[model samples]
Target: MTVTDGVQRVLAELQRFGIDRQDVIVSTNVRTRLDGLPRSGEREPADSGAAVYWQERTGARRVIAIDHYIKVADNLAAIAATLDAMRSIERHGGARILERAFTGFTALPGATAPSWRDVFGVPPDCHDMAVVRAAYRRRASSAHPDKGGSNDEMATLNAALRDASTELGKPIGGEGS
Candidate 1:
């Protein structure tokens, strides 16, 4: 199918999930002619991506983005393949949305560091220092050098604990003031 057809299908699918067209954002790199007009069809190469932004009745704005179709040679093929994948997802079950705030060092470009919450395997809303420390200890058991883990792994756990504790305004080894 053509790129336009793929886009239309995507919009229709989102509508089925109660997401309004106004709440969705479509994006793509458009190939242009010498006269500065967008190329009409999928013949040209461009990177295509889109995001559906939505909010629960009393929740923060959240997004489900599909931007990984870069392997396709041209924008048209990329969007077509993406539509097929979305349809497959619908066939099985709808996409599951997870909420997490990408923060601090994790937000930087090319930074592979996991967020504190990710390192501790805790949900974003779990901010109690006691819970974070318990998570740290649980992970530390497997990350400590004596337990067949490398120094780097243990160091990452330590850093994760420090960052999380600081963000929570709690002392690392003592009760909060």
Candidate 2:
């Protein structure tokens, strides 16, 4: 199956859960360096693919990355596996399990840090401080060292929050009134 087919299958599954396609945001043209690329030979360049983000009506959010070189069958299988895992977590641990799973993965070397909007999982035009703070809390909670998270992850989250605050022109402590 093609990438389009894989995306359609996932979207159709989401629709079965009563999610609108619009609510299931699909982002394309994300170019991540592919592993196992031929380093010393003349070969086709690495794959640049898409990423999908969905926030369930129940507030469970997931991000799935699709490689440009993935086959339709593999993509479909991945979607199926993810759904199964998500359902199991939902059944056993509820939203907390989903939240814990939502800690964004580590970026590969040479990858630039994501923008504040991306870190907050908000639209580029979103400027509401409330929304930014909410996102920051959700992300920071999972990255905090006391919560079994790494120092590096926490540092990144802190940097993102600072950047977000600056972008919104808000004092970190809500002072300067």
Candidate 3:
């Protein structure tokens, strides 16, 4: 979806919860425009989208942002339901969508690095890092053309094999692994 559309949908969600004005926090799956990550600024991180809040009343002594149990959840429905209840609780209107989060994977201990190939679901054999590396080294050398293989074949195989090896070195999961 377009960024503006995403923003609108979120705003509608917050309004449905009645947290559309006083004070609110919002977040979403960051896009290329959010951080200027892309040379063209067109890449969006839709895979990661979420938001939470710490709402406050203008002069209420004890501000209750307790609706977090309703929102700040994992998927869209919880957000919608929370917003609906929040709107019901507030009566008129209250907050707005604030910001969007980004798609990121938690770095795990010895997590194999993601391969460009993995985005397409190819797995590299060998769980041990050393073995994987050695296998790649051998495959790349044999695939090289100076030894007599076609340059096209060598280039294709060696590159694919190398890419797979690099991916195997790290863990998968774009984010939140």
Candidate 4:
């Protein structure tokens, strides 16, 4: 399919997730420096392609830039993969998913760090070590690697536990104690 066709497909997929076409911007004219450095005016044309930018209603924006000089098929494939991921996030997490998907960081919006309180399902002011340990144990039981869970999940749990311990001033697993 043509680049325009690919763009239309992406836009249509985003629209299905309640994103408006007007909130999407497609640009085919982009220039870059040849020396791989940022330059001011009149840089060389990189490729014959387009960049698709979508801004969600909640102010999260993502840009997908494709360079068609390599292969149009590859570009189209990338677009398809991105659309599939976006659809999955929207289906599972709704519009709030856009913030995490576009930001490259899993922290909540306007927050510099991911909250251990949120991960452990505790109140922000909760400082009791017993409460933190109880929450950690419950989460660890379900997220343990041997219980059909992933190593990544276990690692995340460990990190959250450490953070929660530190936040509560009760060091566990030999961290900050």
Best by lDDT: 4
Per-residue lDDT for 79-118 in model 2, tens only?
7456656666666777785555544433446556888888
lDDT tens readout by residue for model 1, 49-158: 54444553454565555666652223334544555676677667555421123344455789777788999998988879989989989998988999989899998899
lDDT of 4: 0.66
User: Per-residue lDDT tens digits of candidate 3, residues 16-93?
Assistant: 544544344444444334432211223444354455453534432222222223222233344555556766655543
User: Where does candidate 2 stray beyond 4 Å?
Assistant: 30-48, 66-73, 88-177
Instruction: Report lDDT (CA) for all predictions.
Output: 0.64, 0.64, 0.44, 0.66
lDDT of 4 by residue, 109-175 (tens): 6645556787789887767767777887898898888887788778777878888777667768443
Comparing 3 and 4 on TM-score, the stronger one: 4
Q: Give the TM-scores of the predictions, in the order they appear.
A: 0.38, 0.37, 0.27, 0.39
Pairs that collide in candidate 1 are none
On lDDT, who's better, 2 or 4?
Answer: 4
Say which prediction, candidate 2 or candidate 3, comes out ahead on lDDT. Answer: 2
User: Judged by TM-score relative to the true structure, which candidate is superior, 2 or 3?
Assistant: 2
User: Model 3, stretches more than 4 Å misplaced?
Assistant: 1-3, 16-22, 32-47, 58-78, 85-177
The best-first sequence of candidates by TM-score reads: 4, 1, 2, 3
Native-to-model Cα distance after best TM-score fit, residue 121 in candidate 3, in Å = 59
